[model samples]
Target: MYPPATRAAALALLRRGSSLNATSVALGVSRATLRGWVRNAGAYSPRVAARATCPRDRELDAGAYAHLLGLYLGDGCLSEHRKSVFALRIACDETYATLLDECVESMRAVMPNSVSRNPAPGCVHVTSYSKHWPCLFPQHGPGRKHERPIVLEPWQRESSSAIPSASSAACSTPTAAG
Candidate 1:
C-alpha cells in the first residue's frame, strides 16, 4: 500500500492541473493508483475525468480518432448520466461481427474502457461510458442530436477526409490497456 503522504502528494499534483501521466512520473506512482485515489475520493467531475481519460491530454492517435469521429457523427448518439458521465453509443448491425469489433476497437483507441454491447433485434448498441465524451466528441453525444446545433470543425473535416471513410481503422496510441 502506498503511504497516505504519497497519496496526498499525488492528489495534490493532480488537483494542481497536472496530467495523470505527469503526476505519476513526477511522483513515481502508477497512473492506476492515482486514478483509484481520485475515484475513491469521489472527484469524478468532468474536468477531472477529462484530464484522467481524454486522449487529448496525451499522444492522440489522430487516425483512429478520425475514424471514430466519422462513425459517431454518422451513427452514434450520446447520453449523459449522473456525475457528468456520458455514454457514446454506436449502433451496429449484429450480423457484421467485424464491424462491431472495429467500432469497439476505435472506441478503446479513443479512450480505454470496458465497452458494453447491448443486443437488440437486429443491431448491437456498442457503448462506453465516460465523463469526457462531450469533451472528446463535442459535436454530439448528449441529448437528442437533432436538437443540438451541429457544425463540423475544420480539423474534423480534414481528419475525416484524410481517412478511409469511417469503416477503416488505423494507427496506435498509448492506451491505458484496460
Candidate 2:
C-alpha cells in the first residue's frame, strides 16, 4: 500500500491542476496507481468526505487544532504501515521533553485514539489507525514544509483565527516568574 503522505501529495498536486501523468511523474507513482488514488480519495476516509461537505464543522477545539497544524508543519508526518492503519509521527528531540508532552497533549485533544510512543531517542510517534490522518494533515508535499507553500483551508483559517491568542500563549516558552 502507498504511504498516506504520498497519496496526499498526489492529491495536492492534482488539486493544483496538475495532469494525472504529471502527478504520477512528480510523485514517482504509476499512472494507474495515481488514478486509483484519485478515485479512492473520498472513500478512503469518511471524515474527509464529511469535511468536504461541511468545512465549518470540526471535532477539534480551536487551540488544539491550531497546535496540531503547527506541529504537523514542523515535525509531523503520516505513514501507512498496513492497508488499514496510518501512523502520524512527529520528530521531537529527546532534550525537549516538555515539547513532547505538549505534542502528546495536543494529539490527545485532537484525536484521543492517538497514543504517543518513543520510537527513538529523539522522536515521538503519535500513532493511530485512522484513515482520516491524510485528510486532517494535508501539508505533505514534494519537500519539507518550510521549502514548500503551506496553505490552510478556509475553515482552518477561521478555526485558527478563533484561538490566536490562546495558541500564542500555549506556544510561548515558560519562564520562572518570581
Candidate 3:
C-alpha cells in the first residue's frame, strides 16, 4: 500500500492530464498500481468530480486562437472521451515535419498544461481533462465541419476578424535567395 502523500501526488499528476504510464514512471510505481490508486481516489476525491467542470475562466490570445482555428479548419477535430476528457486531434501527414511542429506550438501557446501525443501514425493529439476545451475551440459540432454549417460564436467571429498584423506581415516579408 502506498502512503497517502504518494497516492495524492500520483492522482494530482493524473488529474493534470498526465498519462497512466507517465504518472506511473514519475511515481516509481507500476501502471497497474497507479490505476488502482486512480480508481480508489475517484471514489473519495473532490478533484475527480471537479474534472467535469471548466479548468479556468480567462481571456484567450486572439492571435493564437486564430492560428489554432486555422489549423482546426484544415485538419483538426475535437472529441469527447470517457469521464469528461476532451481531446483535440490534428491529423498531420508524416511527410510535413513542420506542420506537426506548428500544431504543437499552437496548442502549447493556448493550453500550457496540455501535452501533445502521437496516438496513431501521422496524428498528433492534444488532450486535456477540462470541460472548458469547448469554450476555447468553439468549433465543436455534430458532424464534420465541412458537411455541416459551422457557425462561429460571436467571440470566435471577432477573434477571427482580428487576426494580428504580425501574421500578415510575416506572410508579406520577402525571403532572401541563397
TM-score of each: 0.68, 0.54, 0.56
Q: What TM-score does prediction 1 earn?
A: 0.68
Lowest summed lDDT across 10 adjacent residues in model 3 is found at 169-178
Candidate 1: tens digits of C-alpha lDDT, residues 65-112 = 887886676667777656777778787777778878988988888777
lDDT by residue (tens digit), candidate 3, 69-122 = 776665666777556456776665555567556657766666654555565544
Worst 10 residues of 2 by lDDT: 169-178
- State the TM-score for model 3: 0.56
Candidate 3 residue runs with Cα over 4 Å from true position: 1-56, 119-129, 164-178
lDDT of 2 by residue, 39-147 (tens): 6764343233332222223456678778877766556666665774557766665566687777778776665454656566434455454555666666654455565
Would you list the rank order by TM-score, best first?
Answer: 1, 3, 2
Two-way lDDT contest, 1 vs 3, winner: 1
**2, model 2: CA deviation in Å?**
35
Which ten-residue region of model 1 has the weakest summed lDDT? 169-178
Q: What is candidate 1's local distance difference test score?
A: 0.70
Of the two candidates 2 and 3, the one with more favorable lDDT, higher being better, is 2
- Candidate 2: residue 98 lDDT (0-100): 81
Please identify model 1 stretches exceeding 4 Å from their true place.
1-9, 12-36, 41-51, 141-143, 167-178
